[model samples]
Target: MTSEELNSNTTSKTQDNALGPAVQLTDEELSANPEYVLEQTLSTILSRPVVCDEESDVDQETNALFTDDDDGDNADGNQRTSNENNRHKQSDSPQTGLSRWKPTLHKPAPSIYILCSLMSVKVLAENLVLGVITDLTLAKIQKYYEDNERQSQKEFAKFQSVTSVIQGLLGISLCSKYGHLSDNHGRVFVLQICGLLTILGSLANLYIYKDSTTYEFYSFVFFYCIEALNAGQMSMVAVGNSYVSDIVSEDNRMVCISFFMSIMYATIGIGPLVGSFLVKIFKGNSFNTLYVALFLNVSYTLGVEFFLSESRTVNERRESQSQYHNEVLRKNLRKEQAIFSKESSKWSKVYHLLKMDTLIDLFKPLKTLWVPKTALGSLVPRINVLILVIIEMFVGGSVEGSVQAIVTYSMFKYSWSSVEIGYYYSISGVGRALVLLLAVPQLISFLKRRNYVALPDSIDRIDMIHLYLFLIFVITAFASMIVYETNDIGSYLNSLFISLSAFALPTVQNGVIKYASKKSIGQVFAAMAVLRHLMSLIAPPLYLQVYAATAKTFPTLFLYIPIILSALSLVLLQFVKIVKDHDMLRRQSEASFNNFDEHINNYSVNTKPNTSFDIANNLKNGKSNLQSNSIPIETTPLFKKSHFTGKDNIRNSYKSLRNSFVNSNTPSSKNSSLDKLKAQNFSAFNVPPSV
Candidate 1:
């Protein structure tokens, strides 16, 4: 019978069995058979004949079945399939195609790099502006209250405390809102908005000084907004950090993150120094001096937005989806695409892409830490989190809190102009930047090398790195305390100690994060944030209370907290050993292949022969190299094949062998030919342990 007649009879038989009614077989049904399916589908979809020897019998029948009326639907499917095939082809094409568009060394796209550098500048500018203005305003207000006969000193003290409390609350609220907005919008956009608000608020403060009575109420409002803007600036920092994390890979994160932080702290030091100089320039006209800061703030924001490329691809994709949604036809088209793409749904693609799972993942570390360990493996990650949290709390309470208190205290006690204060801060900034840029990379490289030598097969070396960081913090804290307490010390000596302390922080912070369990990175970070905010909340009130108690005596009561916090941190450093033990045991259990010696010996001996013959044999035989090597020893099959077989039997036997080779080759083709050969070779050389 002809191929068409055989196909028609098969379709009739299938219909009789299934539906009890004979039905004519369409070209689609004839093409669905295993031998012709792939070729027929490719030809119909690509609008070209698919070269395949196996499909020769059905090709004539398929061509005859294609009519003018069906050509439209076929053409549409073919166009779609062609577009998809082109995309696949493009992706599979060599990297050489992209080489022409690759950035040259000389004509680099330095905007992103420039933006990264400016982040340090922003950190310094924001803190400096906040410090100088807050300090100067509070000082002037205190002096006014003390000199005025209308206001009691006691009442003034209460008013100052209340104002600070109100400012703190405003800061918290604004920071939280800014974080939410940053997630919804983007880091650059939110930062720009905050910058504009800062400029407007500063200008308002300037106007209030010129027309004190008319703008009195508005001035207070502007100052309140400025406090909120300052808090919003903190959110910008968190956004910047999140953005950096998104762009940087985990392996090289420490050095990059340390550089980022070093620049920020260095800027922090420089900002106040510059502000102090500006204060002298404006000479008691604090409001006028702030205008210069306002200008810098606005310019920084504009520079960032215009120059800094968006780091989040998911955010960019969501934006595209939103823009596409605006057109009714495109929205429907997307819905259809969603139906075909099983991986993502229409609504979910937008929502999932926009959601920052990294931020959400921050909470996981905390949950992992809190869970009771069922085994030694479980205990290590949890203990690591505990150690990291302790470290974060100690540093957060001491360095971060003390810096804020000192800046405020110095402005009040020394009567130093903002310009003088800014100079000292700038020195500190320069020192911090130099230390972080120079020291951190060397430290990380040393730690990596040490890990290789000490524990070649350990995943727990990250924990040892964390332990080393704790030791560094301990030394930094001691040096800082000694420098601050020694009155005979030169200004440069004190500055040197402070800069060293700032430099140690990034290494310590990055170390804790690097060693942290992956699932809980976000939560651990959030918990660290909570610890920081809590300390921030407490430090101000404690400083104020100490100042109140020691008003007539030494103003050094404010410095007492850093010294005490430093001592407490040293006490916590002892717990690092407990974490180290847990890490070692965990790594031992997780080590998959303990018989490294035998595997190495076998691997070396088999290397050459395995490469030459094993892969080629496996490819030709259509059998995995891991399977039995013994060929089938069938005596009857030799004589049976030697005699002349029926035409049907010969055709069937040849068809079976062809199908097996085609099926075997098709899946392996998904990977590169070289990779497939390597995999086959490796499997052949490594014998599985006998059951």
Candidate 2:
């Protein structure tokens, strides 16, 4: 038979009644005619509905799958019945295929992986380019000094110090601003801006050192300015962390962040190898690295624009914008209604510009680190936030200083080339990355499985332990460096120790998140970025200058800086406390109680009286009996309306009254309940005393 004829016959039989038996097609006809076979197969498959756990999304797919036929009311009824059957089946089975994958697309794993890939590529490119630039700069300075060792070294140190200061100064404001913007706009938005800036900086770097015959020191400094405009490297770190925070829940945030951080460090380790290979291929030319860096930056920016979804929802963005605008309006209104007169002259304007308040405005972003008083009026959150900030500063400074001190010290003392220095950093990076990736997650999982660190309180304590261990490792490593100059073996041990200290920042961040609200995550990380830039400003000058001055006498004197910072951090970590959000707990309890009360009230009001109960009949008799009383019921105090102070009391009173009425209607109890009811007070129920 023809395919059309076969399909028409099958539809006619099926549409007569949906409850009818199936029409079986002959196997020979199904096999012999491809058209009929295909039609029958599709009809069978489409007739059976696609079932999934997520009914809402899957229902859309199911609707789109079915095509309507123009055959009349019978066909329409059959189609409707089929849809209903599909829905029923969907309710029974779990979701599969694309629908299942869609739910997890927004989950933490995919987000972390995306972020890691983006950051690793960016870091890898950066390390390659930056290493080449540093070597080129050193070579250029050596020429100006005519190969004078001390003079070239001093110039390089000064160059490093100046660039760091400039980057820090710009980064302080930019990082905080970008962070605030990310909270309102989106994390991906900030990342895109930073990525574009990074690409520009790479282009500028290429232009500055395009020619081997001349070096543009001023131009190179401007290049640093461009990078620092988006808070330099720290901006990416802050935004990336905030992005992770947006996706991951508090329970798993620490582990995910550590893993994220580990990936970045792992990239740091791997970047050098890639960079060195590039340098080797280009025959010692570093300029090619900039091209590669620029390419990576462009690719990353495009990826972010296309692939990454915004973490903040439309409602969240709107709410954040509303709050921000309202705050700005309030501030503006306050300024307009000033208690003091406005400045009337240029001198006054100058005075205003130099005012302490004006200076304080520059540091206003740091206020985010101080937890504001909530409705609960708790001091613990504020204290914990402060402690976390303090720990971050000390620990962050030490870490930053150690990086500079170690690199400069290695370069000068061991006379290591750029490649050798890269190798050293790579070794440390690998060690850190492995521990954070492999060990940290397993440890967290083990603890969770054992039920040791279950709640936020327990998590806080674990963070403290991690911090303590990190500080101990840092102290031991740096202190050992102070005692004896590091050889290859010493460097290996030091890297191992430093690698173990990787737990500090991630743990400290977890603590910070615990104290801060979810909305303020961007601001919190921005404040952290600010602190890191502040360290960058202070650390480079202090460590590099100290190393420059004492290189010949005691190069290891700068090592003391990190040791001191770590020691101070270790001491301050003791003051950190774990406090639950009492306000949130109280709100949750009150809401639960209200929900229960509402349910009980709804039950009491809507429940119908059963014909088996004689309460309705009794009410009529009691009313008539009361009306016939010789003493009027109007003057009786028991008949007056009363207010119930407690809902619980009202509910209990109603339940008791209901039970008494039910018992009074029964043949087994009969008048026994009536006597008890007469003795019982009904004032709590706002009814007259029982008759």
For model 2, the superposed segments whose C-alpha errors exceed 4 Å read 1-110, 139-157, 212-216, 339-362, 407-420, 457-459, 482-488, 544-571, 580-691
What lDDT score goes with residue 105 in model 1? 26
Cα TM-score per model: 0.55, 0.66
Candidate 2's C-alpha lDDT?
Answer: 0.62
Give lDDT tens digits, candidate 2, residues 1-691.
Answer: 6556866865654432122223333434333443332233223323322212222323232222222333334445655676687666543322222223444343333377888888777777777666677887888788867899998898888888788677778888687678778877778778778788888888777766666546456766776568667677677888888889888887888888889888888887787678878989989877787888889988887676656766776445544555566666765554444424464555544554455444554466687778755434446667777877776776667766667667767776678786676566777889889888987788778766766563453236667668788888888877766566756455556667888778877887777777665666888888888888887777666777888898888778877777787778777777665555443322111221122122222221122222312222322333333344321233222211221223233234433443433333222232333254555543211222121
Query: Model 1: how far is 50 from its true place, Å?
Result: 29
Best by TM-score: 2
Question: Which parts of model 1 have CA positions greater than 4 angstroms off?
Answer: 1-112, 124-146, 149-167, 174-185, 213-222, 227-233, 279-286, 315-379, 403-429, 446-498, 508-530, 543-691
Worst 10 residues of 1 by lDDT: 14-23
Alpha carbon lDDT of residue 196, candidate 1? Answer: 66
Model 2 lDDT-worst window of ten: 587-596
